[model samples]
Target chain A: DVKVTQSSRYLVKRTGEKVFLECVQDMDHENMFWYRQDPGLGLRLIYFSYDVKMKEKGDIPEGYSVSREKKERFSLILESASTNQTSMYLCASSLQGALDTQYFGPGTRLTVL
Target chain B: TQLLEQSPQFLSIQEGENLTVYCNSSSVFSSLQWYRQEPGEGPVLLVTVVTGGEVKKLKRLTFQFGDARKDSSLHITAAQPGDTGLYLCAGPSNTGKLIFGQGTTLQVKP
Candidate 1:
């Protein structure tokens, strides 16, 4: 079984604070992704990384950024947290394939109060 | 744009009942996958269908991919309380990024 570990399960931050969500995968997958899941809207992609020092913006990457300094770890950054940014964040990784299955982390539920 | 659209955004049923969820799309995909997610947890992969007109079964669950590879369905027989969760369908987008449908949340009461 593959393991995708996230740094936090629940988080709360004040407005204007910087937030970081860390993820590590032990599956040696080449693709990593960040998505925010909300009611009615479902999961929307925020950012993704295919390799070290590589990042691509997803459908919704306006106020978020991603870092992949190493192959096994990817991090999501919220430059300035806001009330609307409060939602569940998910991280996933997949092997090098166009149709490969993505393994997901436990997810981080962030609340900006 | 989301490539897949799931039906019945929410479903609640009694244990031992059967239900079906559908994932429909206009564009063809190389493959599609189903995932089940519990509260406070990430979505977990349940099954993957690659070929058009393919059908895969996992115990009491049956999965079918449309002949055009643009749709799919999952039928659960003899459902249990443990089957309650958010069921999601995902496929690869044109840009290589994965696209997800508005998942169907199922709640089964015993």
Candidate 2:
């Protein structure tokens, strides 16, 4: 079975602080994604990486950046966390195909106070 | 822009009840996937339908893809408390990213 793990399950940060959420997959998938899920908003993509050092912005990428220095790890960075940035962050990975199924990690609930 | 719309944002029912959730889209997709997310956990893929007018069954759950490849439905028979979760449908875009629906939260009481 494919497994995706996140660095933290819950995190708290003060306003204007830098925050990082990490994700790792054991399936050796080539595609990884970051998304923030909110009530009534579903899951909005923040960023995605198709390969090492390759990144793409999704629908809502503001105030967020991503790093994919290795195939198994993907990190989401908040330049300066704000209260509005508090959300449940999810990381997913899929095989190198458009129609492949994405396996998601247990989300990290970030609280920006 | 491609968009997927899901109907009945919420549903609550007793055990042994039947329910169905619908997912619609104006744009066509090559495939659609259904996922069930439990509280505090990431969404888990339940099923994926690729061909138009296709039906697939997994235990008491049935999934159907529309003939136009633009819609899908999930029906659960005799739902139990264990079936309670948020159901989400998504389709891959031309850019290879997925577009997700608003999701349907279902609570099956014992």
Query: Highest lDDT: which candidate?
Result: 2
Could you give candidate 2's per-residue lDDT for residues B1-110 as a string of tens digits?
Answer: 98889888999999999999999999999999999999988999999999999999999999999999999999999999999999999999887789899999999999
What is the Cα-based lDDT of residue A88 in candidate 1?
Answer: 93
User: Across residues A11-64, which tens digit of lDDT does each residue of candidate 2 receive?
Assistant: 999999999999999999999999999988889999998899999999999999
Worst 10 residues of 2 chain A by lDDT: A94-103
TM-score of each: 0.95, 0.97
Across B45-105, the per-residue lDDT of candidate 1 in tens digits comes to 8999999999999998999999999999999999999999999998988887778899999
Listed in order, the DockQ scores are 0.70, 0.73
Q: How many residue pairs of model 1 clash at the backbone? A: 0
Evaluate model 1: give its TM-score: 0.95
The interface RMSD values of the models, given in order, are 1.5, 1.2
Tell me what TM-score chain B of candidate 1 gets against the true chain B.
0.97
- Candidate 2 residue pairs that clash: none
- The CAPRI quality class of candidate 2 comes to medium
Model 1: lDDT of residue A82: 92
Q: Let me know the TM-score candidate 2 reaches against the reference structure.
A: 0.97
